[model samples]
Target: MSKFEQQLNQQLHDLAKEKAPQRDLWRGIELGIEHQHDTGTVPQNRHRRLAAVAASVALVVSLSWYGIQQTSVPATDHPTGQALVKALSNQHEQQKQALLVQYTDAPAMTENWEAQLAELDEAASAIKAALKEDPNNGALLRMLQQVHQQQITLIERVHAPQWQQI
Candidate 1:
């Protein structure tokens, strides 16, 4: 035969000679079936399997419950967080009211100054409500602080002499 054909034949022969699995898996299955049939234990095995599945589910649920309890913040921290937010908001409102009263007689550069302040108040209230829901959220607290600061700055800027000219 040619060199290429000889090589192909050798490859085919090697493929044909590949060994099968070491053990007969079907024999083991047949023996198990026979044993179950002779002993009348099929129903018991099914029940055992069901019990194992139920135990695994219970274990998973217990672990999840433990994880949630562990990850939750301490109960004492919740009130403290809300209290801090409350104090800051009270202080902000007092300052905002004072600024509004101070600038009431002053000529505001913007005609819609009250409307703008109302918008800021609305935004602050929304943040405050969100904080009530998630008291420990630092970003929400910071945003509330920023909105209050903006209100103060707006009041000052609109009543300033430079803004009046512009």
Candidate 2:
């Protein structure tokens, strides 16, 4: 071994022979325990407070979620509702036609895409019929919009998948 390693070993031997300084730790621990007992407050109280806070937070979150669901779409009268529906339908048709023209020669990934589109169209028609009866129904309007979006997403996915580009 080199001189540095020999010196390190000698230091380690000297440390091993030395005795540790002694102190009474039990008195301090006992004092702390007595003080805690006198205060009448335990760790369980902290846990209870944490649980209560968690419950309140959960309740607030649930209420906010419920409120959002209830007010997602605003109610509208017959004329305004009909106009909105017509506008959305016109835009969807234009987009669909444009996409079809763009992918005329490209083959779709799935053979049943046309059937899926037909199903979504039928659903849209049903929602429209429901809207005619209750023009101010916000939920129905939301459903119609969701179905239209789904149709567009399906068309896009079938024509040009993200994985295909990679």
Candidate 3:
């Protein structure tokens, strides 16, 4: 089609017409095998090397797991964590209810706004369940806060003025 493609095709065609190697390719391999047998030099067992690599990986993984377990804070260790989570949850609920009340008469820009809110609520419920198990988890706390913020944001966006969106 193009000049580059024509050149590529011509080169491939030329290579296809070239003669193959004249000598037997297996002769070199057979000589090497005979030489090794004469010298009594055996090839190293591949399984032993594979096993050593596997053992090293296993050791490193186990040590890393142990280190992580030792460093992480236990769920039940922090007595005030659950109280804090409950307080935050209560505040978020109140704020959400107030927001809904304020926007009760406003029509949402998107038809699926309620469905989105429901999904966020479900995510929040799951996070709360996880918090019950590991109350002191900082990452989970942050995720819960983010999800709550997102719910509030989504509500505000859907009810916001079209000019404000622009």
Candidate 4:
């Protein structure tokens, strides 16, 4: 044979020799049956398989129960969140309108000062109500702090001596 054909034949022989036999599953079963007959107790380990199956079933049931229980909890919006928002908005609007000046040509503007003050007081009361609802809300608490400061300043402004020292 030529050198190339000789090398190919050797490779093919090696491949054929390396092929492993198929498994004889029935032989293993026959051996197990013979062993069982000899031992009379079978050595089956069925108890271990049963325990594993039971553990898997228990895990499934526990997970299913947890999923059901978690789904049943009702989520709701906090009423305090609404109150906090209202208080913040009320303070914001009041601050915006606090700079209003009486128009000299508008009689209605000059005539309604007391009524406007009453409305502002009502707004302040709403802010206080919001604070009562959400005492722990940071935004509401900060607004409340500002409200107290504004109240003190307003009182001081009203009570300060008018040109007495001047």
Output the worst ten-in-a-row residue range by lDDT, candidate 3. 39-48
How well is each residue in 1-166 modelled by candidate 1, as lDDT tens digits?
8999999998888885567888889999999999988887988888899999999999999999988986796866544577988889899989988987887788778799789889998999999899889988989989989999999988898887553565
Tens digits of per-residue lDDT for model 3 on 14-45?
A: 88666789888899999999998776566445
lDDT of 2 by residue, 1-166 (tens): 9999999999888885666659888898999998887885777688889999999999999999988976885655324677878887899889888888888888899999999999999999999999888876889989999999999898888999989876
Give each model's clash number.
0, 0, 0, 0
- Give the per-residue Cα lDDT of candidate 2 at 157: 89
Deviation from native of the Cα of residue 139 in model 4, angstroms = 1.8
Error of 4 at 17 (Å): 84
Question: For each candidate, what is the lDDT?
Answer: 0.87, 0.88, 0.88, 0.61
What local lDDT does model 2 show for residue 7? Answer: 100
- For each candidate, give its TM-score against the true structure: 0.49, 0.52, 0.50, 0.26
Which regions in candidate 3 have their CA more than 4 angstroms from the true location? 1-79
Error of 3 at 155 (Å): 0.5
Candidate 3 similarity to native, TM-score: 0.50
The true-versus-predicted C-alpha distance at residue 105 of model 2, in Å, is 1.1
